[model samples]
Target: MRTISHGISKIEKGISILLMFSMAIVVTLAVAFRYVLQSPLSWAGEISVFLLIWISFIGGSLGLKYKSQAAVTIVVEYIPENIKRMVMIVGHICMLLFLFILIYYSFTWILSPSVSYQKSTTLLVPMWIPYMAVPLGLTFAAVHLLSNLFDIFQKGESQ
Candidate 1:
């Protein structure tokens, strides 16, 4: 289980790095075209927007895996140990539910004919391609949540 989790983490990190690099390249080209050539790349804005969507979704999933999502822990810390455990369990369950909903809707959204029918006005790429990141990220987050829940149960059993 540890190995599987580690592998997923590594893959997520690698994809994130690639997305960052792609965004950097797009920004560089956009700037060069607008300033150096005195003409903006018409497609740059559309491409950047699409890349931003992908980055945001994937980054969110990575955050879940790392438990890096922003949260105020002071309230939880003040709670009694047993209550805190219950709160943690409930929170994880909520996250799992949220992820599952996201995955389902995102998949349906991506599969809708409207997605394939539309193209970016400037980039001329199918909208579905960028929209795919939604389901992909949600799936990753759901997997991480389930894994964490399993770990929690295992620890409880041991105690």
Candidate 2:
């Protein structure tokens, strides 16, 4: 399970890095063209927005893998170990369920007739291309959550 999680995390990280690099280049070109040449790129803004969405989602999944997400551990700190483990498991389960729900609806939304025929104003690409980040990111998060839950069950409160 850890190996699978690691593989997924690796792929997500690689994708995020590439997207970040592309975003930087696109923004730089946009700025250079707008300020220096006085001719703005019509698609730059839209592409940048798409890149940012992907980066945010992928980075969020990485956060789950690294356990770097924001948490209010103040109350948890004083709790008994067994109860704390239970709380953690329950929290992860809740998050997993929520992710699954989001994944299901996102796919439905992406495949709907309205969205299926839609395209971005500047890029003319299918709208679902951008919307895909949601379900994909949520799915990655779900995997990480399951991996964590597995670790908890196997290791017994070591987390």
Candidate topping TM-score: 2
List the candidates' TM-scores in order. 0.92, 0.96
lDDT of each: 0.84, 0.92
> What tens-digit string does per-residue lDDT give for candidate 1 at 17-108?
98889889989999999999999988888888888888898888778777899999999999997787788899999988887887888898
Model 2: lDDT to the true structure:
0.92
**Model 1 whole-model lDDT (C-alpha atoms):** 0.84
lDDT of 2 by residue, 63-99 (tens): 9998999999998899998888889899999999999
Q: Which pairs of residues have clashing backbones in candidate 1?
A: none
TM-score of 1: 0.92
Candidate 1 segments whose C-alpha is farther than 4 A from its true place: none
TM-score of predicted model 2?
Answer: 0.96
lDDT of 1 at 143: 77
